[model samples]
Target: MTLKRYNMEKILKIITGLAGALFALIGLGWVIKPAAIAAEMGLPLLEGTALNTQIGDMGAFFFAGGVITLLGVLTGKRQWYYAAALLIGTAGVFRVLAFTVQGATLPIDKLIVEIVVLGILLASAKLTSVPQ
Candidate 1:
């Protein structure tokens, strides 16, 4: 039996769809403020500290990125998909940098997940034949 070569276009489509879903889920998590997430993650719900404010800002950015990615997927806009993916990827890199600078224990699991996602996005961008 021989395995068939995967179609790049099809893979990109799936990647875009999955990325959109993941972003939307992240947005929903931020909007909902579930107790389990808060307790497990030590995320404060209501307090206006510098850290909290920064988190809120990042949350807003993530929410918007999710929406944009969803729209790009639905509309078949390769450029939009690439743009959102790059933005999210860059943000993830910055997040890791910040964690390191703060002398904080890195969220290895989350960073790995984000790295995987970023790889998918980059591959999708290439497979879709979209100009970077």
Candidate 2:
């Protein structure tokens, strides 16, 4: 590969790694203390057995994603980008579907952010993908 192409691939891996780390960080927050995070987001801080079961599920999901993606980047395995794409892109798609089903319950800004993340993730996946 050309030096420029190699550099681009490295940059892409780093970006993906960073994104995964942030995702894990947020998930950690959700895992560590869902009540505080939920309150900050103006969500109901439900307190009960059922709440406990549900609260950490998202945290675990993102945390696993982050760990996997970071490991892939560190190992120079470009394939993990596909996992990140699937996780993030699917989330964005589901968000849009929710809007369609629920009629725009989330704020426009939130939707925009999700869409942007999805776009960037997809572009990054495309940029970094190669036949290995």
Candidate 3:
């Protein structure tokens, strides 16, 4: 690879790895301190089964997305990037839906993060490759 391309790969790997770790940590927070995480996310911790769903579903979403992203970076696996991209990109799509269809205020900050991360993952998937 050319020097510039190699440098770009290294940079992307570091960026994606940090993003993955951040997401996993957030997921852990959801499991360990659901109320605090919920408050930060502007969500309420509900009672009974709803609370269970909140912790379980949200935690799994973030944890899995993060783990898959890390795996992609570590293993240079394109498939893992595609998987993470789909997971995060779907969330982005739904955020738009919430704003347009559900009459919720635009979650612009979160959406920007999601789109940026999704772009990085997609670009990484295209640029990175598995070792033979």
Error of 2 at 9 (Å): 2.1
The clash count for each model shown is 0, 0, 0
Query: What C-alpha lDDT values do all the predictions have?
Result: 0.66, 0.68, 0.92
Worst 10 residues of 1 by lDDT: 1-10
Q: Tens digits of per-residue lDDT for model 3 on 49-98?
A: 99999999999999999999999999998999999999999999999999
Predicted candidate 1, C-alpha RMSD: 4.1
Q: What is candidate 1's local distance difference test score? A: 0.66
What lDDT score goes with residue 115 in model 1? 80
Ranking by TM-score: 3, 2, 1
lDDT of 1 by residue, 55-77 (tens): 56656666777777777656665
Decreasing lDDT order of the candidates? 3, 2, 1
Per-residue lDDT of 126 in model 2: 62
Query: Which regions of candidate 3 are displaced past 4 Å?
Result: none
How high is the lDDT of residue 58 in model 1? 52
Q: If both were scored by lDDT, which would come out higher, candidate 1 or candidate 2?
A: 2
For model 3, what is the alpha-carbon lDDT of residue 64? 92
